[model samples]
Structure formats: C-alpha cells, structure tokens
Target: MVLQILFIAIALAGVALFSYNLKKVIRNIRIGKAANRTDQPQKRMMTMVKVALGQTKMFFRPIPAFLHLIVYAGFVIINIEVLEIMIDGIFGTHRVFGGMGALYNFLIASFEILALGVWLGCAIFLIRRNIIKLKRFSGVEMKGWPKSDANYILITEILLMTAFLVMNAADAKLQAMGAAHYTTVGSFPVSQFLMNLLPNTEGALIAIERGCWWFHIVGIFGFLNYLPYSKHFHIMFAFPNTYFSNLEPKGEFSNMQSVTNEVKAMLDPSFTPPEAEAGKFGAKDVNDLTWVNLMNAYTCTECGRCTSVCPANITGKLLSPRKIMMDTRDRLEEVGKNIDKTGNGFDDGKSLIDSYISREEIWACTSCNACTQACPINIDPLAIITELRRYAVMEESQAPASINAMLGNIENNGAPWKYSPADRLNWAKES
Candidate 1:
C-alpha cells in the first residue's frame, strides 16, 4: 500500500509537470496569427496517417529510415507493457493483466522483442551521431543543446530498454523459483538470455527485479517531462503537425488576406474591402507568423534532412531550412520567456527577423520546396523562411538589389521583366 501510494504520487506529479510544459508550448504556438488548418479534415487525417504514422517520407533514406522505424515501432508497441506496469503500481497487484492468459503472453513477448529492437536501433543511432558523424546530424543549428538533447534521448531510451529487459529476466527467474507474488505470466524471449547475469539467490533476484521496475517507470516519467525541452518533441507533435500540413502544391505560396483584399479593391473599384486591420504587412516576429508556422518551428526534428537536401545550403549559401526552423523555435522560446517574465503583450526588442534569422540567410533561399518534401513529418521550414522574406520586402523595404529591380519592373511593366507587352513579341521576331 505504501509503494502503491508512492507510485500514484510520482505518476500524478509527473503528469502534472508534463501538462504544465505542454500548456506553455500550446500558448507559444497560439501567439502566432490564426491559420485555417482545421479545414479539410478528411484529407488531413489521411496525411497524418500516411506521413506521421506510416513514416512514408522517412524511407527516402532507406537505412536510417529502417532503423528509425524500428525505434519508432518499439516506442509505440512497448508502451502497452507500461499500461500493465501502471495498473500493478497503482493497485499493488502482481501482473494485473496476467488473467488475459495467451493474449497477455503474446503481448509481453512482442513487447520484449520490440524493446530489444528499440535498444538496437537507438544504439545504432547513437553510433551514427557520435562515431560515424552523419552529415545531417552535424549542422550549425544542431550544436550545443540540440546535439546534447538528441544524445540524451537516445541514451535514456537505451537505459530504459535495458532496465525493462533486466526486469523481465529477473521476473522470469523469480517465476521459475515459484517466488511469492511473482506470477508465471510473461514470456521473455529476448530477456531470457540476460537471466544468466542475475544472481542465483531469490532475495537478490527480487531486489534486482523491483529495482529495475522502479527505474524503468521513473525513467519513463523523466523522459516524458524532458520531451518539451528537447527536439524529440517531434515524437508527439508529428501527428498533429502532419495533419495540419499545407495541402497546397509545394511551389504555391500563401498570400496575405489583407494584401489580397487590397489588391481586389484596387482592381475592382466596386469591390468593398473589409475594415482596415492594424497589423504589420508581413511577419516581423513569431506573433506575425501563422499558428501553423509557429507549430512547424516547435515540431522540427533537427535531423537536418531538410538542410541536407537544400540547394542553397548545398551551394554554400547561408540559408539552411533546418536553421530557419531552429531560429524560429529559439526566437519563439525567447518570446515565451519574456511573456512569462512580464505580461502577455511583452516585447524585449527582439524579433525573429534580423534577431535570430539574418537577412543574408533569408535571401539565400531559392524558394524551392526540397526541404518541405524531404521532411519525414512534413515540417515546412520554407513557410517560415518566406514569411521572414515577406517581412523584409514589405515592411522594411530591405530586399536585395536584384529582387528590388525585379519587383520594380513587375510594378511598372506588369511583368517581371522591364519589357512592355508589345515589346515582348519582338523576342519572337528576333527568334
């Protein structure tokens, strides 16, 4: 009963802390302008299923994708055993679902296998990051906390899986010994090998089993709380992020409704424009971007897959789509902290543009959708980049000379080129 109470308290506290952090993330995301991602419910569901759940886009790099899928599948499937653990912890019962008989055995067996797979996958991933030094994992944005965060998650997962297997092995030994309260329920196909390492004494085996059990559950709670602060938050956010994915063609850019209304009014004098809204022409900060844009920032995996495929980055340009998302997220976090310190409408003289993201970086983008297509969960770093560019051009009149000349030509000649409509036909004459 004492242990049960302790478990309940620990679980409740863990859940409460996680909820608090999750609320902060949601509030930060809501700081951005409203976007209509709620539309196309059916299509969104399909996208979530195909991309986030199925991990269809990850297969672009088969080896890493396969390893990642193993870890991903293991994470989802092994959590079923956590349910049983929770039940046992709360009720002070042994193997609470053992009554399910063959079904329970099958579940435990599968979980054991998956746990091993997760361990192996995470181990390989660690090697790939630290030893092999994969290019995608070594971007400028991935330095410091981002790099440490990835390592922390992988190591923690490895430890948790190890504890799980050890716990099972000890439990199996206990069952064989006909120990009290240690039911002969689970099938330890993978953990069975670990049984040889455990002590032959019953008391020592129980101690090891109980210790591992506590460690595993506590580690899970710790991992859950750690996620919001880590890039691995993608694990949870991927589903919703993919669901709210921009369904438009990759090359298509979103137009500001305010600008659209103004254009319509100018083109058709009879067209009544809505009441003028007081806001910046384009995104100057996190608040100026759409909620989906902010969500995309928080959802970035920092895998650098976007950066790897970027033509701009490939050609030695300052623009890294991955860095754009990272900067947005960093800026959003800074803004969130400022708001927490002051009130809701606080400003610290720092904005995403020219603060976290540089003008050179913004202008370096070729406007290609390579990054968007390369993302496994469909995170659109390009969307954030374009918003910053819009802010620079419209609000600050800070576009590059080439872009300024092109825009001037379009405004004056009704085309991107300086040639008049009549003169356009002269090119055909010359041909």
Candidate 2:
C-alpha cells in the first residue's frame, strides 16, 4: 500500500512538471503578434488527421519513411500499455486489464511486435545517421548538438523498449512460478526467449522485474520532460502545426499587411484603410513575426530536408532554409531566456536579421517553394526568410542596385524597362 501510494505521488509530480513546461511553451508561442488562423475549421480538422496523424508527407522518401513509420507507430500505439501501467501503479494492482483474456493477450502481443519494430527502426536510423553517413544528417547545422540529439533520442528509445521487454520477460517467469505480486497477466511471445536469460533465483527475478518496470516508467517521464527542450516537441506540436498550415496556394507569398495597406490606400480612392498599425515593416525579430511563424520555429525537426532540396543551397548560395528555421528557433529561445531573466520586454536590441541570419542568406533565396514543400511538418522556413528580406527592403531600403533599378523603372514607366507607357504601342509596331 505504501509503495503504491509513493508511486502514485511520483506519477502526479511527473505530470505536474510536464504541465508546467508545456505552459511555458504555450506562453512563448503567444508572444508573437496575433493573426487569425481560425478560418476553415472542417478543412483544418481533415488536414490534421491526414497530414499529421497519417504522416502522409513522410512517405515521399520510401526507406526512411517506412522506418520512421515503425518507430512513430510504435511510440504512439504501444503507449496504450502505459495506461495499464499507470492503473497498476496507482491502485496496487497487477495488470488491471488482465481479466480481458484473449483481447489482452492480443494487445500484449501487438505491443511486443511494435516494440521490436521500434528497436529495429532506431538501429537502422542510427546506422543511417552515424555509420552509413547520410549527407543530409551532417553539415554545419547538424554538426554538434543536432547530431548528438538525434542519436540520443534513437538510443534512448532502444533502451526504453528493451527495458519494457525485459520487464515483461521477468514478469512472465514470475507468473510461471506462481509468484505473489507479479501476476500472470501478459502474453510474452517475444519476451519468452528473454525468460531463459533471467536467473533461476526467485528473489533475483523479482528484482529484475521491478527494476525494469521502474526504469521504463521513469525513463518515460524523463523523455516527457526532455521534449520541451528538444526537437521532439514536434511529437506534440506537429498535429496543430499541420492543422493550421497556410491554406492558400504554396506559390503565394503572404504580403506584409502594413505595406499592403499603404498600397491599398494609394490605389483605391474609396478604400478607407484602417489607421496604420504600429509595428516594424516586417519581422526583425521573432516577436515581430506572426504566431504561426513562431509556431513553425518551435515545431522544426531540424531534419535538414528543407536544406536538401533548396536550389540556393544546391547552387552554393548562402541560403539554407533549414538554417533559417534553426535561427528563428534559436532567437526565440534567446529571447525567451532573456524575458525570464530580466522580466523586461523583448528589447534586447539584437535582431535575427543581422545577428543570426545574414542578409546574404536571406537575399540568396529564389523564393521557390521547395523548402516549404520539403518540410515534413509543414514548417515554412521560406516564409521567415522572406519576412527578413521584407524588413530589409521596406524598412531599411537595402535592396540590391539591380532590384532598385527595376523598382525605379516600374515607378516611372509602369514596367520593368525604362520606357514610357504611351510608347508601349511602339513595340508592337516595331515587331
């Protein structure tokens, strides 16, 4: 009774810690300027179901896709077993659903199969990242912490799954011996082999079972806490990110509303443009960006798929869409920490444009939607890149000489070339 009470207290404390961190993330996201994404509710629901839940975008690359599916499905579906673990932990019971005989056996068998899949999938991913040397997995962006993080997640998952299997094996052995607290609950089709590796001593067997059980649950709590600080936060945020994806055509770029409103008043005589909103011409920092852009930052997987397909990156230009996302996330984290420390507003004076993402990288973009399409989580790194460019051009008038010449031509002659509009008919006659 005392042990169960202590376990329940630990479980509640773990949950509390997770909730507090999650709220911090939510608060950080809300720091961005508001834009309404509340439109198209039904379509949003279907999109979340199709893209995030189904992981349809991942299937574009077959081998990695299938392997990812194994680990992802295992992580999600096998977690149903966690419910039983929780109930048993809290109530001092052993496999509370054990009474549902055949169904329970089938569920356990399925979990074991998926656990095996997760183990295999992690192993292959480790090989692809470390040994086989996938090009996308290395590079400046993935050099130190990013590379280590991927390996850490994969290895931790392997160990967690192993602990689960070991726990089941030891439990099954105890059941065969008609032990007291370790009930005859689960089917160990995969774990039965592990039983032979365990000791013949009953006390030693009990220790192994308890050790594995406690480790599995404790590891899960640790992983849960780690998500807020890791790219793995996407495991929770991916659904909402996909659901709120830009519903417009991918080729379209979102205009800066402040600039657009200015142009609207100039063109439409009857248009009563609302009083000019006060903000930077475009995003100079993370807070200047829309909440959606910030959300994209938080959700980035750092998978480098955006960089892999980038025309600018391929052609040796400075732009890397993956780096843009990382920069945004890094800047956001910096700002978040600053806020926490100083309790002051985001007036640290350091901006993402100059400090983190350089003008060369932002200007190198062809504005191609390749990066947008390549991101599995629907992250729009190109949008952030464009935002920075917009800030440079509109606020600082720092457009290149060639672009300035084109703009001058447009202003004088209503065309890209420096010819009067009245002379436009001369071209047809000459032709």
For each candidate, the alpha-carbon lDDT, in order, equals 0.91, 0.87
Stretch of 10 with least lDDT, candidate 2? 253-262
Q: What TM-score quantifies how close candidate 1 is to the native fold?
A: 0.97
TM-score top scorer:
1
How well is each residue in 1-431 modelled by candidate 2, as lDDT tens digits?
99898888888888899999888788778888987888999999888898899888888898898999999999999889999889888887888999999999999999998999999999999999989999888667787887888888999999999999998998999999999876677788889999999997889998998899889988898899888888878899899999888888998887667777778888998888888877887778888888899899889888888899999898888788888988888888888888889985477889888999998898899888988898888999877887787789888999889888998999888999888899888967985
On the 0 to 100 scale, the lDDT of residue 65 in model 2 is 87
Which residue ranges in model 2 land beyond 4 Å of their true spot? 267-272
Error of 1 at 209 (Å): 0.5
My TM-score estimates for the predictions, one after another, are 0.97, 0.96
lDDT of 2: 0.87
- In terms of lDDT, model 1 sits at 0.91
The digit string of per-residue lDDT tens for model 1 on 156-223 reads 99999999999999999999999998889978899999999999999999999999999999999999
- Alpha carbon lDDT at 28, candidate 1: 95
Candidate that would win on lDDT: 1
Relative to the true structure, candidate 2 reaches a TM of 0.96
